[model samples]
Target: MDSRGLIIGMIILLQTTVGILGNFFLLSHYLILYYHECSLKTTDLILKHLTMANTLIILSKGVSHIMTAFGLKEFISEIGCRFSLYVQRVGRSMSIGSTCILSVFQAITISPRSSDWKGLKTKAPKYIGLFLSLCWILYLIVNIIFPIYLLNKKVKSQNMTKAKSFEYCSPGDRDGIMDSLYMALFVFPEVLFSVLILWSNGFMVVILYRHKKQVQHIHSTNVSFRASPESRASCTILILVSFFLTFYTLSSILNACIAFLNSPSWWLVNINNIISMCFPSFGTLVLMNNAPTFSRFCFIWIRNKKSPNFKVAM
Candidate 1:
């Protein structure tokens, strides 16, 4: 491989590795908490779903980008291409939707007792499963149409008159109607989810500011700055939303131009995938910083590692 290819491949490999491992650890933490700890909290359940989706994104997008980066052409068959893109799109959408739900739910959780939306605090947890189910169903159904129109790079026409190409896959057919449907099915939900994420984050920020002021007012000189679990979770949502929106917006813009670019550069395609996966890669570590259970789990793990079980030499 050339220098550029080598560098791109290495970067993708690192991202994929970190994203997969981090997400798996987070997912396991939540699962253990759910089964061993009696029951999972509502927010933890949402995070479990988010972590699962991030892992899916890593598997779908990371593999394709790595193969493309190192010039592994046509290694994937048509069915593989279809499945990859379908999984990629669905995972990306689900990740965004979960983040949106998380931010909104946290906002509701932290709202003042007198707030009009306070009742949701009691009722929202009941519907989380339904919300997640709908999210999966919506994205899966919408992206299901792409398989028939996708081709492995090997079989894709050099000049299908008009085509949208990815590094390892291409649209076998396209018309105005299909294009409209693509925007409707894929882009619209992404846009909606992003907006919701922003709105919820904003709400949480406002709530936090007001709460801080109230705390300060009551305690003139000796107020505790230590944040509560709700505050920390709100901050996590804010960071996650900020990180997610920045990359999500850039990826969307690049995706819009992919169909128009006569031949997109190597850097262009891989960079788009990189941006799409960036939040998933780093977001887990961000959550880890805030997750007390994860910290405790790590602490126990390291202590155990430092003092391994062994028979002393007599």
Candidate 2:
């Protein structure tokens, strides 16, 4: 309706479009790779779950973009709203949980000498399904109230109305309780997991430095390929964490600004939607990058499906 809203809408549209395309490509790659590789290992399973989570987030973002574009509130039906919000929240939590597990698993895999977790690496693959099941159950039980209290359209008191015209589901109903619970349930664990991931990464970095120093002392100029995979994975994790942290900080600042102003501008809403989708979109990007060969294989399969068949000359 205003210049600020228009600008924010355009930016969100651009970001959402890019994120959707990027994630779609990544999802396709990983699915194909999973089938071809057929590992069924813990890492593979965790990655598959992560991809599924990203796909759900992409769907959520697409719907949100459409709603914003049309200036529509409560875009979906009541049931649809409940389902969408449920899936979005569950998917996001799954992504975080799976990532934490991944980091912990990798750290265990690399641990030297006798550590409590090191012995579990041999059995990690067996427990992946159990871990995922637990994650789903925990989040489902906690967020049961989310759908009932937050999603559907309902009447609000005159005190809560902006125009005193009609009733709409107020965004702030679950604000106090949900915010506190979210911090305790999700945010606190995320902080602890991130710290562990960083510490594990630091261990690997120190080892790499020492390894390089030893090689230098011998006047050896050969590049060590042994460190490549671990290094790459560490770098990828760092970038993923960095992106999540940056977006989370930005969202916090935007929220604080809105609170300080005592009113939310249309631009702030658009920006919030955009930033909310950032971590999922970027996680999809990193996963896709890690599976490039699978992307090529899938492309070839698609092209072959559309081509005419030819008979062999005998």
Q: Pick the candidate with the highest TM-score.
A: 1
State the displacement of the C-alpha of residue 38, model 2, in Å, after optimal TM-score superposition: 2.7
Across residues 115-162, which tens digit of lDDT does each residue of candidate 2 receive?
566668688768878988888888788766677766443547663544
Given candidate 1, what's the lDDT at residue 167? 66
Looking at model 2, the pairs that clash are none
The superposed Cα distance between candidate 1 and the true structure at residue 140, in angstroms, equals 2.2
Cα shift from native, residue 193, model 1 (Å):
1.5
Q: CA lDDT, every prediction?
A: 0.79, 0.63
Superposed model 1: Cα runs more than 4 Å off: 149-156, 160-166, 218-224, 297-314
RMSD of each: 4.8, 5.2
The per-candidate count of clashes, in order, stands at: 0, 0
